[model samples]
Target: MAEASNGFFSAYVDSWDVLQIPRIGGFSGTVELPGSKSIANRALLLAALGTNPDRSCILKRLPDSDDVNVLRNILPALGVSVVAEEQGVRIQADHHRLSASSGEFYVENAGTAMRPLLAVLSALKGSYLIYGNEQMNRRPIGDLAKSLQSLGVEIEASEGGCPPVRVSSDGWKSQEATIQGRTSSQFVSAMLMAAPLSEKEFVLRLEDDPVSKPYIDLTITMMKDFGVQVLRKDYQEFIIPGNQRYLAPEQYEIEGDASAATYFLAAGALPGQGPVRVNGLGRSSIQGDQGFFRILESMGAMVKMGDKYLECSGGSELKALDLDMNAMPDAAMTLATLNLFADGKSSIRNVANLRVKESERIHGLKTELERTGASVEEGSDYLIIQPPSRMKSARFQTYLDHRMAMAFSLVSAGVSIEIEDPGCVRKTYPDYFLDFLKVAQK
Candidate 1:
């Protein structure tokens, strides 16, 4: 695998074979998921902002992915050094300058880079053109651009809020930014990460109810951990004073990704699979997506919860339960898989954010789930799924989103099926398919 600027395992899947795995054995074993790419990126930025002379913060469990590695490379560019600890990052990048060599900065297939860096470059004050890999560029940045513009930053888009985002410096010492609440929290995270560097102390507010409070909680936690003082009056209102210095201590650690844990939990729920116990993040953990386990209990999976371990086993005839995916939209696809096997019908609402960032998740999931014999319907903010009379053999499109590819792959555990872009799972969890295959015979 070729290394990306941030460094985890990153690969491009131009062509892949659609192969079938006959549903065979179930699994009961212990495995660990990679770090939350979201937290890694945020921590990298926070590490850069950390003021404590301590220099190192010990993180318990961290996942490795291309997005997080990009963050590692980023610190040194700004004169910070990131050393890899057993489970976290030790960071110290203090001197930052707008490198005048603004020709073309390329970040491949990284939404994390596209969002936060946009704010970083804007606050650093310079004329810069940010271009991404074809797929990354196609993802919408309009909501972010509009919000950035509202704060008096100049962000010119190619069209439809798609990227090749051109950001010019706003001379103000500091700026107050307002963003649409219904969109991805990445927009707000982007602005907050850069607020420490704004000439004046910054203030940020959301126009609507925030979509992902869990992610926002992560950002705030990382900010404070990295030695930056950030305040939120309510969930909607936040304040970060700029013109302060960014001090990086020697070390920090990233946590395991809870989103990735859903698949393993689901596999454990399969009848006669033994038991699946995944290590890393658990109760009292900072991640909100951890709540997916609760959603599973709602759908019939037996969950054994502990202070630091979540053990699940699949045995009951899954029931249909309506869900609100507004909190954790990234896992909506995983929820769709549970719905596919339900005895009745399940519906998901408040997930319109999928349309803007993912090319065609709703369509991709619906087509593939239906192709596998599940009755499903798609809409702007809702998805309806009716259990299939029988599972069938079908090849599904992944559209480069790892979740899409991995979520649908679950069908293979009980049927003969092929996935068009199985390799796409590497986008987040590089060893997802390979590791999953070891646990489930199907």
Candidate 2:
């Protein structure tokens, strides 16, 4: 078996420094989070699409992470002028067209940048080469390629249906196509983002129910916010009138990241810990990952939520749960660790897509949990976790996945554990351990 492809994307954390987890009774405190990665990438691309030839658009409170940074660096290559500000970036795109006749882009492991850029670039007049890190190249792009081919664009994927993609375009001809969604919702979103620019009315039909369906909703909602309307039929189909254009607003403020909040929220819910309040996301949060707090509340955590904030306090005991997590795969990883503290076994289902992430998450969870003295069972689309009678100290391997590092960090509360390649969290939450330490200090 090969080592997983996810690891440090740039010079930030290449040393693979071993991080020792400090034993703590509990964690509770106020921690402000960075902006939403999903929204920031989408908004940045939309800003480019909607930019007038004469003016620039400002995006505030952008996420400071490697995935989002990929978009920032690549934008200028495509003729988008970017000015780094104190909080975010100022972008001005000239008619949303590439400055050069052809371009080469290295997106590293940022799927958000690669997938969407694939769709948008396919419609422009250019020859483009889009490649990523080994881990990203391993993630499938076939579905998106087939969908683009249906619309009369030329694209070629490697033998495994992965990246190192080559896209050549004069423009597209077809107005309608059907794409499957069993693998990733990003396939659907990529097409939607590029649909309005089609030469004719565009209609995209899904062959099956989309995994991570809520992300598609985020895409549609953000598209509307940029002044392009998509006619949707029950999440199965989308219709975009041809010749429509994205309208960039004067400035857009990004919301707090709900996925990144999972650690602190769970820390507050650890038995005997004080209440933890997270600002930036609340009842009004558009991110589907926010539903994670609801899962915590269901499992006996006391949660108080308002329009802009949420506080969670550990219950007398954490209860085991059996539930589907297809809509929130990233956040659901936290549940695997939380289940370790439950009195009985817990189950998670409808997450087959997790296998294709930065690591084989289901297998990784089973292997690492067993190392900590827990009984684990793996399924094609699910897992069942049986808590250990007493946690055993172990050195957990992060496998280059940020979520893996963060989820396993929770084990330190039960027993002091060591985490290998802990800096991998820089992919999303750069100061995750620092913030966790802050909460633990209280």
Candidate 3:
């Protein structure tokens, strides 16, 4: 890839094999986040499903990240028209045209793209093949495939029950199915989004509590916004009336990415000179990662909230925490690194799902944190971190994971460090280092 400048940053992120982050005084500025990748892709699919000749869905502030782009690029194959505008994207589709379409799609490593796309594609009267990069192919999709198969959708996953999924269906043939949710909530969310496409009432029952449950709520909330209602009995069952279709809203604005906000928030909470504020998410935000601010507060960081913003400043002393982060696994990566600055050992539990994410997060965290002199204990579903007496400058590998790259950047608050494959952040936040430089005082 050719190096391109963002006008602000001197070099292109993609051209860098290793990028050095200097120890900084601290961050003390506001960062305006991009649209939430989770919301943007979900909204994109919903908008495409809901579009008609009478109404076109105009989405505002949709993010221009690799993940969202994957879905955007593939929409045309499904007979949906996606046009880029100055503000966001406009989507339109005819139900008859969409139902009759069929094609191959490559989703890269975006779970948001692959999971939901699988369910939606299966609900249409078409034959489709959906595959992704090597990393995404390693992520399991069997639970979702089995659930769809039970619904009478002919589907087959790879040998290991991973992706490169093939689906052939003339539309829904059954009304009720059971899905195992313990592996991933995306499976559950996928089924929920597709249920409305059935001609009869669809009843979805969960076999176990889903990991990252908040994301399911996000899907339900967005589904309602698109004018589809889902009745739920706790987390175990969802009843989505069939013979219903998504009704596109005139326009929907995506909120700032709360996951991306965690890095700057941690910078403010570190032993710094002053406060750092992140604009885009507040108490009213739908993202579960917004709860990360509460985690910062529990760690003794001074936090203030508004309806659309969160502010944080260093406290007298950072306190360690022993907490379950099942609902906010993405933010948990940031918390894991933040533990390095705490007063004592910290333990983040109930995040074994991290092992199957874009990278094997638990093992990766343990390995990299140890390189920085932190004593880390890795578990099947948890991580225990003991801050070293003295931080060590080390070269950290990102494992092609965006969160890993951003989380380890926090180490610069105490010691100069080098991060490998810095461009991996383009998966979500393309301009991460440039934005980091804005608030970062070297």
Candidates in order have lDDT scores of: 0.71, 0.85, 0.89
RMSD in angstroms between candidate 2 and the native structure over all alpha carbons = 4.3
Model 1, global lDDT: 0.71
Ranking by lDDT: 3, 2, 1
Cα-based TM-score, every candidate:
0.89, 0.95, 0.96
| Among all candidates shown, the one with the greatest lDDT | 3
**Candidate 3 per-residue lDDT over residues 3-107, each given as its tens digit:** 334322225346357777768766798889899999999999999888887788889988889999999998887778898787568898855336545788999
- Cα error, residue 220 of model 2, in Å, equals 0.6
Model 3 segments beyond 4 Å from truth? Answer: 1-16
Decoy 1 TM-score against native: 0.89
Q: What lDDT score goes with residue 350 in model 3?
A: 96
* Prediction RMSDs, each to the true structure: 4.8, 4.3, 2.2
Model 1, residue 242: distance off in Å is: 5.6
